[model samples]
Target: MNIKFSGVLVGMVAVFAATSASASPRPDAGHYEWRAGTQAPGPRAPLAVARRVWVPAAIAMTDADVCQSMMTAKSGAMACCASHSS
Candidate 1:
């Protein structure tokens, strides 16, 4: 395509985009803003750490390949992934 044609195409897209944006409402226009912080936070419990969680050290790309590798490596998350993937 010639430069003139490409320029016209870009100009048309810009025009449409500008019109659409002007017609659309502002993102935060209808939302409520929360400002209340009068109440104090309750007591927090100490975090517990797992000693023997089987998280995989090696990373793989595909879901099936990851499952297989993790299964071989005995990762606990792979067992959980079986439920989610199904």
Candidate 2:
């Protein structure tokens, strides 16, 4: 009985490991290629670069604007400032 239970447990573990490994995304499955001198199709590369730069700047500007607006208002200043303090 103990041997049978151990075998079943080991089988279950093997099945789970196989399924998890197969479910993961393959490294080469995306549009971008990592080989030297092989640029991703035009515009996509630049667009990705721009996004990396612009998104953080835009978020910071938005947070500053919100904080400024909240300070100007008499009520809810504490709550707004507290939330944005982070």
Candidate 3:
């Protein structure tokens, strides 16, 4: 392509890109913001470090220990007082 035509082609592409960018919604408008102290609304929260400790113990758990450990894990959000039951 000729130099002038190449430059025009480049300019046309740049203009198209700028127009496309401006036509889209602001990027932040589609995002969710979480506030401090308020936990996200869900049936369950993501697992934390202390909670992960129960998995090995949970695998070894007897029928009696299942409900007890589950409540301990959920309520504390971590296993501070959870004594593993065999």
Candidate 4:
């Protein structure tokens, strides 16, 4: 019957989704050779928080930064970055 075939198809899809959801990947060991004389990469800083997006603090932005940031609109330079706004 069409109803029985549809029911079996839905049941198979549900079982497949449940099985796929439980297969999580293993975490990394985070091991490294600190004495190898090469510098290791440090933690990365995120670009955005809560609502505002910004350039990373480790990066040095120039005067052109304000122009680029406001490229989306004709707003004043005061609207560039809330953290640096006076």
User: Number of the top candidate by lDDT?
Assistant: 1
Clash count per candidate: 0, 0, 0, 0
Query: Candidate 2: where are CA atoms >4 Å away?
Result: 29-86
Write the residue-wise lDDT of candidate 3 on 21-77 in tens digits: 999755544444333444455668643322211111123334645555555454445
Error of 1 at 35 (Å): 15
Give per-residue CA lDDT, model 2, range 1-86, as digits (tens). Answer: 99999999999999999999889776334343233433457764742322111111222234766657654344434445545452
Clashes of 4: 0
Can you tell me which runs of candidate 1 are displaced by over 4 Å? Answer: 25-28, 32-86
Q: Highest TM-score among the candidates is held by which one?
A: 3
**Candidate 3: RMSD over Cα atoms?**
18.7
lDDT of each: 0.57, 0.56, 0.54, 0.54
For every candidate, C-alpha RMSD to the true structure in Å: 16.6, 11.8, 18.7, 16.6
Please report, as a residue range, the 10-residue window in candidate 1 with the lowest summed lDDT. Answer: 48-57
Give the RMSD in angstroms, all C-alphas superposed, for model 4: 16.6
The model with the greater TM-score, 2 or 3, is 3
Candidates, ranked, TM-score? 3, 2, 1, 4
* Model 4 lDDT per residue over 1-86, tens place: 99999999999999999888766453232333323233445567343323333332343455766646663424433555545455
